[model samples]
Every structure is written in structure tokens, then in C-alpha cells.
Target: MKKILIQQLFITTLMLGLSHNALAEDKKPATDSTPRQSTMIILDGSNSMWGQLQGINKIVTARESLKTLLENAHGNINFGLLTYGNKKKSCNDFTLVSKPEDYDKKKMLRNIRKMNPRGRSPIADALKQAAKNLPAENAHILLVSDGEESCGGDPCAVAKELRQSNPGLQIDVIGFRDEKEAQLECIAENGNGAFVVADNTERLKTLLDGVQAKARTIVNVTGTPVDGNLPGSIEVSIKSTHTGGTPSRANFSIYRPDGSNIASFTSRIQVKEYLEPGEYRVKAQWKGQSYTNKVIVQSGKTSTLRFDASQSGMLRLSSLNSNKEAVKANYSVYLANGDFISRHVHQDNVDLRIPADEYRIKADFDGTIQEKNISIEPNVDNNHVFRFE
Candidate 1:
């Protein structure tokens, strides 16, 4: 009887062990296998976006196109909306309307509809802000602007800066009624992105479709081998393809294949250096902006990289009394559609770096209010005097 009990106990223990294993297997956690990608839509809210394109305002066309784009962007992708010139007139007029999260078409459309173009086009500042808002290391940016940088900011320089910080950042640009193709193209190139022109709503939709397609597609890069250099030594060259001019000076930070900082140097315009045959990360800074990229220096061959640079402008606001003399007063600026830009309190003069745009100025001198309209041109010092009678 004791022998029989011992055999039964062993069988029971074995069954319990098998049952525990089955329970543990059933409780295994599930994880998503899909890769996550992020895209920030930097929409232009400057007054220029209100201009007509094919019988409809640019803003309306953009909204419709974006609606379609978002509808198609449904997947494991995060979408965020950022707008410049929609809220205020200051050069720092960028607002993160929506934070990047799981794709939400309705929320994005609602936010886009709420935007009213009233301020200056601070394209560079917007780009800089996008860099900070996006948490993804390899984020994609889609900038749709009806005009060039209206605020005194260099979009190309900022794009280069973002590239330096995040080598995988891509910035695609859509120019709506923008005449400066080279400027927008330079921005795209600096961000290692694409540029497209949209003259009408149909074209805008087409361009957006292309952007979506590119976003969904994965790119496979294959490097070619070269000859002539010594073993473990490779030749590298840096080039500038900016529109305005070459950067005065550029600083480079090199990283080894093991992700350790190896060396750094400051150079001008184009730079060439001999490096070891391996994977490397390079960060270049120029004109207050940073750009980062990767290079696989193969033994015996040379690799050339390119950068871009652009220009900006400034605006000065001064106050005058009926006597044509400078006087201290409070000022309120607005876009043509009566949207508020900014307000300066009790100041005789205010200097601001702004993109080119038409503005309405309202001055309050000791409780008396006066209004005037002014237009600012790019690449020059725009001085506006508010005469309070």
C-alpha cells in the first residue's frame, strides 16, 4: 500500500507541473510587432495662406488636402499639427496645436479648421520648434507654406541645425503660391527631404499623396565600395548647396562606430577629412544651426555630403505724435483681417526680426487710439511709424 501511494503522489506532482507550465504559457504577454513612425505637419497660418488658389483660399485647399492625407495616414504612425502665423504676429509665432500621438483624423481636422491665418511666416522658427516638439529620433516633417520666411529666420540654417541634431530627420516642403523655389528647395535639401509645388487644390492633394506614399515606404540603402585609399582609411568631403551663400564657418563633431565621440573640428564652407573605414556619425554646425548625418567610410573611396544656407530680414516699429516727433505709446498690431498680432506697452520703439507681410498697427497714446496700415518687404530693414493724432 505504501508503494502504491508513492507512485500516485509522483503522478500527481507531474500532472501539477504540466498544468503550471500550461498556465504560464497561456499568461504570456502580447506585444505589438508593428514599427512606429511619426510625422508632424507644419502648416502655414500666415496671412498669405488666405490668398486665392483656383477660386478657393489656400487655407481651405490645404484643409481639404490635409483631411484626405490624414484619412490615408491611418496606421501605426503618430500625427501632430503645428501652425505658424495663425495666432500672433511675433516672430516667435509657432503653436503646437496638437502633440504627436496615435493618428487621429477628426482631431487633426478640427484643429486645422480652427486656425485663422493672421501673423508672420516664421518658417525657421517653426522648424526649430518642430525639432523640439517631436520626440522621435527619426521624425518626418511636412511644411506647407504659401510664402517664404516672413520673420527674420533662416529656414535652411534651422533645417541644417535639426539635421545635425537628428540625422534621421526628414523635412518635406510644399510651396503654395511661393515664388522662391530655390529657398524652399534648399530647406528640403538641408533636411534631407523633398520639395513640391502646388498651384491648385488638385495639385495640393497630389503632392500630399506623394508625401504620404513616401512616408509609408521603407528605404533600403546600399553602399558601394571604392579603391585607392590605404587600409582602414577613407576620404570624406563636405559640400554646400544653399541658395543665398555658403556658411561662413562650420563645426564638425565625429563619432566612432561604437557611438563614442572621437574628434571635433571647425571648418569653413567645404571640408574634407581622412577617416577610418567604419560607420561614423557627423554633426556640423553653421550660422547658429546644427546638422547631423551618418557616413560609412569604405576603404579606398571618397564620400561627399552637402549642406544649405539662407537669409533673413528685420522689422522696426516706431511711434510718432501729431507733431511728427517720437513719443512713448502703447501699440497693438494686427493682420489685415483684424486678427491680433502683438501688443507693445508704453514704448517709443520696438525692433523685431519679422518675415515680410502686410500689417495694421493700432497705437494708444494716453488712452487715445489711432490705426494705420503698413507693408513690410523681405531682405531689408522695414521701418513703420505710427502717427497718433
Candidate 2:
């Protein structure tokens, strides 16, 4: 009887031990072998960053915004920094401040603060360089620029190339002003990313936070979220030139085939609306002109409508004296109907990206007034030098 009781107790003890061991094994944490997402921050160090907004220097605002981004970044994402035009005035002026790695707040902040804007904007090349440093196939590039490319590089084309070659890459751009907003839009659109305008510090911080989150919110230049939810979508883009367009400032209205109004909203470069699968008419009002196009939307798919608002060309104007030396002059641009487009003062040279049309240019050099009529053709560069007698 004693042996039987001891044997039964031993069996119970052995079973309990085995069960505990099995439970411990089941509770072990699983390991994740997937790599972290990486993002590269391409800061624009162009001289124009010295420009002020609401009495604060843009560079200062950018620095503060970046600090906020770093402080609030997620641990799963690794960030790298690349800056251009910060060291000196050169087209090739850019540096890889840091490589994509674990977020080092102190080190990153130190490098960001030490940067100063002093050079030209090499946006296209900077995009190329940033693409090369991407450690992982799935990566993001955030380009912060106050101006367009000064190196004569086509950033839009480069962005398209990067996106097409790497299916997982996305590029987002931030522009400070409305000047050349269309070009910035092109970069974002071609790169399969988003563009947001941050003219002030608060907006910059908010925009940076949103970008860091990797949660895509369809926002326009005004920072407003697009409103729509339906079965299908239509994307409308109106451009003055065949190569690039400024749909950001265009007004859009959509209608059904029966002539009933469906939606009306202003475009921020490109506007997309979700609707029931059907045919619709899209009209775009831009530069005091209206253009219309027809598109058919299919369920679970997005249709695109691109309107060629007008052909566009480049106009380069320079002021020179009889001695062939550059002289400061005031110039005003007007349409054929005498509508004023823009005015510049005391600039020896100015480049105008305008729709192909008849234009009247009035130049004043030390009170010597001159008027000229010129026609611009699509994709042509018209260089006109005003020589004062």
C-alpha cells in the first residue's frame, strides 16, 4: 500500500512539471525578422530659405519643424538626412548628413541645426543622390524646398524615373510659396506621393508630423483634406504646358451626362473625386479661361482627365545698356488685352513661364521706357535683351 501511494504521487508530480514546461514554451514571444521602414529627409539649403515668413526666417522655421519631427518620430522607422545648397553657392552643393539608421535624436538635431542655407537649389540631382542612399527597397523621400530648381535640372522627370524604376519608392515635396507651385506638384504627382504648402511655422510642424506618420491624407496646397467617398474616382489635371501644368490654382466642376451638377471644388494641382461608376464631364477654369473634358469612371477604379489648357513657353528677359553691361530695370508683363500678369523691379534678368500667347512687355531703365510685342510658341525659349540707348 505504501509503494502504491508513493508511485501515484510521483506520477502526479511528473505530469505537473511537464505541463508547466509546455506552458512556458507556449508563452515565449515570437521574433519578427522583417526590416524596419526607412525614410530620407532631403532639406533644401537654397539661399531663398533666408526669406522670411511672418517675421520668422524660413531656415529657422524649418529647423524647428525638423526638431519636432524627430521628437515625435516612431521607433519603427529609421530616418536619414540629406541637405543641398547649405554650404555654398554651387549647383553640386549637397551632402548626406546622416545615413538611414536608428533614430538618434541628439545627433540628428545637431546636424540639422548646424546647417545654413547659402547655395543654389540642385533639386533634381539632390533627388538622385537621395535615391541612391536608400538602404531598403521600400523607402520614402521628403523634399523640403522654398524654390524651384536653380540648376536647370528637371526634378519632375527625375522623380518619375525614380518611381518607375522602384515600385515601392515615394517622394513628397514641400513648397513655401505659390511661386512655381505647378512644378512642385509635378514632382509629387510623378513620384507617386503628395505635396503640401507650409508657409508658416505651425503649418510646417503639422505637415512634418503628418509626413512622419506615413498615414496618407489627401491634402491640397491649402492643407485641407479632400472630401469624397464613392465607388469610383476621377482625377483631373489642367496644365498650361504639355510638359507641366499648374492645376493647383485651377477651379474644377463636375457634372453627370444629364447636365446635373455632381461636385464642384478648386484644384490644388490635381483634384480627385470619388463618385458612382458612370460617365461625367469635367470642366477646369484657369487663367481666366475654361476647358472641358469627358471621362468615364469604372467601379473600383480611378479615371484620369488631363486638359491642355494652353501651350506654354519660356520667356527670358535681360536688361543691358549700350556698353553691353547688365543694368537694373523694371519690367511689367501684360496679356494682349492689357491685363496685368506680374511686375518686377530692378532685376537685370527675369524668366517668365507663361502660356503661349501674345504679350506686351514694358521695360524702364532709368526712365528710358521701351515697349515690345512678342509671341511665344510651345516649348520654345524666347530670349529678349532690352538695350537702352
lDDT of 1 at 375: 74
Candidate 2 lDDT by residue in tens digits, 182-245: 7876787677665656664443443455454342121122332232222445667776653365
In every candidate, how many clashes are there?
A: 10, 2
Q: What residue runs in model 1 are displaced by over 4 Å at the alpha carbon?
A: 1-33, 200-206, 218-389
What lDDT score is found at residue 94 in candidate 2?
Answer: 83
lDDT values, one for every candidate: 0.67, 0.73
In terms of lDDT, the poorest run of 10 residues in model 1 is: 225-234
lDDT of 1 by residue, 1-389 (tens): 99999999999999999999999987663245444457889999999888887778989877876777788663535788889898888888778877676445677889888889999988998888777778655488988887888777899899998988898787877776556666776687677664556664443454455444433332211333222132122222233445335444566666775657654544544343435456777666554444455677644344566543333235577777788899998877665655444577988787754334677778788788877887756567877777776
If candidate 1 were superposed on the true structure by all CA atoms, what would the RMSD be?
Answer: 23.3
Report clash pairs, candidate 1. Answer: 150-354, 150-355, 150-356, 151-354, 151-355, 161-290, 163-292, 164-291, 164-292, 229-300
Q: Per-candidate TM vs. native?
A: 0.48, 0.51
